[model samples]
Target: MDTNSKIKRLTILITCIILSTISYGQTSIKNINLKAGKYKVGFKHYTINDCTRTYRIHNDFNNQLIERPIPISIWYPSKIENNSSKQLTVLNYLEILKEEEEWNDLPNYFLLDWFPYLWNTPENKAHLSEKVTAFSNSYFLIGNFPVIVYAPSYQASSIENFALFEYLASNGFVIISSPSRGTETRWLEGGSSKDMETQSRDVEVLLKEINKYENIDVDRIALMGFSFGGLSNVITVMKNKNVSAIVSLDGTERYNYAILEKSPFFNLEKFSVPYIHFAQKEIPEEVLNSDKIPAELNYKFQLYDSLKYSEAYSFRFHDLSHSYFSSFGVLFANRDQRQDKSDDKIMVSYKLMSEHTLQFLNAVLKNEKNAKEYIENSPVKNGFSESLFSKKMKQAVTKEFDYKDFNDLALDQGYQNLIPLYKRTIAIHPNLELQEGMLNTLGLRLSFNPKKLEQGVNVFLLALYIYPKSANLYDSLAEGYFYNNDFENAISNYKKSLVLNPENQNAINRLKQLQE
Candidate 1:
């Protein structure tokens, strides 16, 4: 080989290596710069066993019916007095990852190379030393703060989205989460419907777990999830009524509506909470074709399209792919050269996503006026370029006011002043009715209770007013007065009942007894 030819080949090889290094460079977590809110963030992690569900430890030879181990990671608003030495570093969160991933004894040094998604690189090594915002076991702020129950991506750690959790906690929101695992083991059955259901149950456990904290506002809770976790959260919202709102970070609910539909609990009518979904950029044609992904996936969102009763917000970030939706993904996942955006663009979009999440939570959970305005405004109005972002929102459909709705109103005021309440409600709903049967049964039930006899009489009066000349309503009214020991009113109602129905046997017997 000639020396000149060898030198030319060497130059070309060096050029290719330099270009490849630039193309595959990793993102530094510091570049994200997620702004913290007014409150100090506190983080705590512990494990509780769900004894109701049996689980098998794959490593155990006996495979006994041990309780399902749920490892909980929580971030919440805290008092400002935190020991600087105990402030959590990124490595602390990775320790939680080890425990939840069943690698409890793995040496901390090998974490980067041990996980397939976490590359062993100098940039990633720097992340381990970077200090996060949360302080370990800091005193909780003394107030009822809204909570968010998070479900992690497929078989992922509860602390997977630590950055967002801290961001939300610093804004006075309590975030609780557990790892996503299979029904019977630490691994899932290939993301099947059964896997979806198992993850949903885990989220419900977190829902009940929040009640233990006195500072948590149980009345106002939201569910947030990433990837497969998103699918589980949607099912959780459908099966449970307590969730006030839900936030999805590039959630699979957009891509796998079929899996959701398979769950018996999935009824669109039950999914009426305020919901927001932040999506990934459209996959490039080359990537789509090479990856064998369906082109319709770029446009089809059956769940969003089919929804009719939720205040839904959908945003597509042109700069983010699905993996970047999570803190762990942003820091650890490898960038696909065919479709991944530049690290700078990805970090900027992540900051925007976090801000949008805060505003949405404030608008729905706290009912903040400014937050509502911010959420309702378009992306361009909020200062983002239209080419980089797009949004679509759906206002919930107005449901009809039915008898059950009226009954709730009646029950709230102890059934007193129903006539006036009905008058006001009917004037507005014109179609609303307090059914004769429901009122009669309600009156009888109340009358039988000695302490509620007067309320029963009030209910009877309302029933008669609505069903004016009905023999049954008058008889029920007579019964209510008789139960209350008001002989004069009881006699007057019995006579009216007899007038309405000459053969009213119950009214006849009651009147004769009263006379005797």
Candidate 2:
């Protein structure tokens, strides 16, 4: 063959090879279509009748005997038909809102009218009741779904993050959340490991209580948390052998706390259950250090290895803020129309984080094959490079003109065709704002497609540049580097992560093993 012919043949060969490589790397994750519905369990409200208990006050006050009441609301899958319009936990709602406003430094006005879309009435009381009831009514049943025990943040009641509790409850999982004593006031002051241990014991007691009910698979239990709650879940899962898995959503890193004289690293070896740590982009560096985190948890399986069970799967969304991982954030953001999409970063973070959490839970708790496949092969599960985001964004923009016609066609195709159109719409939108529905679609695609990993990483890195002191970003970069076999780079990034978070055991151990 002539030189030009040979060159053409070689070009085609290289193109095919690259395309094949991309195809081999990609994995598909299915969208979890949770139908909206309402269901309630017949819970007999009863307070824990402990007549006298010694309580310690924070103001150097003496221990006093007091009666502590556990007002419980049990929500289980029931055959009762008249439970549709039941009002949400009103007393709990008011108390939680008051506490959240102070903890998050949010204004009272924003908290009063959280979801404007759901509000429509002259009587504010009725509107609030309807809004909450509607939320409670929308339940998604994952037939025989595993149990997830949620530990609340320090000095924060279980009801404080009702949005998250409601969402999880609606998504087919039975969530058991409780407010520990001293958990409703001065959160930061009471964020102690001892408090977390006590909360874990509370979970154990709650689980025993739940056994009295029907249809709960006690063996398949997972522990999860948000913020200080995340730290609590970690300690809980580590201490409790009954817990099959542990999940952390923007949890406090133990690194900063590890340096304290009363650190909670006593039983690191007892923690053998799988852990899924979903970090926000704005986590402080003080929480990412290796020395601060227990050394055992730093192994590749628990740190950088995504394929193994008894592993740690960590991800950091570049634009995700600390408060974005819970439903309370959505209500907070919707309160102000002038606020940009960036303000709802927590909502976006929750959507993505929830999908992964569900997947991880399925893999560990239910032993779902499809979920495991998605976790092993998906870009989100493995590691995406930082270069692919711009490419995907550009591709999305280029296809915008065709979106209108596609939507019109979809309208005639029984709305099923609109799913693709909706996916394209997300790609086409240039606002960089993350909508929950749109994010759910794109995130599923990103998780499954290895070709998109580079793009996802690129987008995340761009986000990191905007928020540099982010421990999550460093952790993500370290994961990407480990996947790419750039162990040195991964180690360096992990070290940087440690500088920001001195207690990240996973990062430290991974670095040590890789160095060895």
Candidate 3:
């Protein structure tokens, strides 16, 4: 052969070798060895169009406004007979992916190539037939289970993290997820602040969607996200009060705090839930320089640093990179050999991530004692080496005893002992004040409801004690008594109101009517 031809053949051989090794040692879901909990896992897929928002299919011949399509994937604890033949396979999840990606007609043969992430390798092909824990069309378990509403990574499928969802469901939790899509279309606007809000809103829709499920314990809820989904979830947690905990899997909130801050609802105080963030290993200097990624990303987490009201736990899994946080990424994503760890190490770290997520959820949502200790303790104590995984936990700085806390105490005792509760709360939280306006509105709302008249009177009484000289409180208290047929007390409060404000015409009229 000529010298030039010999050189060309050598180059081709090297290129083929590099390409072959890029996704070496790909793993199956079974190889992950996630021990299933006592409950059987059930899978359900359904679509709900959000009527409030309009969407467009960019590929349509004539673009038109239509209700935003939200494809939901739910995994919950089930009691169905364990029929292996009926269980969902990896292919089933990717089929859902095909529908969600706006290519509903895309043939199964082209699935791997159509999406850049899923490689068509021998190991990846094997995964398609593997039976996951979840059985499709299975009946949900009888009892109410805690919920975890998941948001997928940027423009990803709802079932991107199916393995984790199945594991959670097997442990008696309900996992709801929708694809991360643009505000108006299937594609995002280059991962902008708008994208974050859109995904956050999608998560909120799931929050409302949870209401339909009779088996869900709405009070016990958590938000889990990967990559950009992580950033979106922070805003979700801020805007929502129902979320009790949040889990981030190598979330972008750490790398892109500015995008998270751009949200109007962004407030550190609102993130007062039990939070756990599992971060990828520090990007090697070579990759950082080559990829133009900022080195500050490895250490600077403004959100984690600013959080003072959450029992925050931050962990670094040394063997995993950002992609491995999701099941699809671990099993199919082409590894960046420059920064990606070996396949064995990645699998181990993923299992670690899954366990930690379970422990954190158990601690905050299920209130499991052992899980709480597992989350609070050091990585060494959790049976992992410091070199492989490291942890940092910050106890929630005692949250302020706000009026809501005081009200909860008052509510528990039927609003009878509010005055004593207020006094007790004041001793602990010196600055705590039951705002006269809040008390007035609350009292009026309750007083108008005949069933809650007594509770309303109690609220007004507490208000009067706080604002002794206020005519409004006296007038409101009189109205409460009037509504309850307590004429003598009504006349007394009307007179008190007149004493505070002689020009109080309502009080004057009320007192005249009572005297007559």
Give the poorly placed runs of model 2, Cα more than 4 Å off. 1-46, 49-53, 56-64, 71-74, 83-92, 95-145, 183-190, 254-265, 282-309, 333-341, 380-516
| Residue 177 of model 3, lDDT score | 98
lDDT of 2: 0.49
Better of 1 and 2 by TM-score: 1
Using lDDT as the measure, the top candidate is 3
Minimum summed lDDT over a 10-residue window in model 2 is located at 388-397
The true-versus-predicted C-alpha distance at residue 153 of model 2, in Å, is: 1.8
Output the TM-score of candidate 1.
Answer: 0.90
Q: Tens digit of lDDT per residue, candidate 3, span 1-516?
A: 543333233222221222322645578887899999999888989999999999998767467989999999999998776554278789988999777988889999899778867778888888898988888878888998999999988788899999999998989899999999999888887677898899999999999999998999999999999887888999999998999999999787877777777789888888889889999898789865654456677788888899998889899999987778989878987777787888888888898899889988998998899999988899888777998988898988988788898888888999998888888889989989789999998998888788998899899989988998989988998898898888888899889999999999999998888888
Enumerate residue pairs that collide in model 3. Answer: none
State the lDDT of candidate 2 residue by residue for 378-491, as single tens digits. 453345443211111000112233434443544465334334444565576644333333323332344235555454344344435445776666766676667766678779
Best by TM-score: 1
TM-score attained by model 2: 0.50
Q: In model 3, what is the error at residue 184, expressed in angstroms?
A: 1.3
Q: Per-candidate RMSD vs. true structure? A: 8.7, 27.0, 7.3
TM-score of each: 0.90, 0.50, 0.89
Q: For model 1, what is the error of residue 273's alpha carbon versus the real structure, in angstroms, after optimal superposition?
A: 2.2
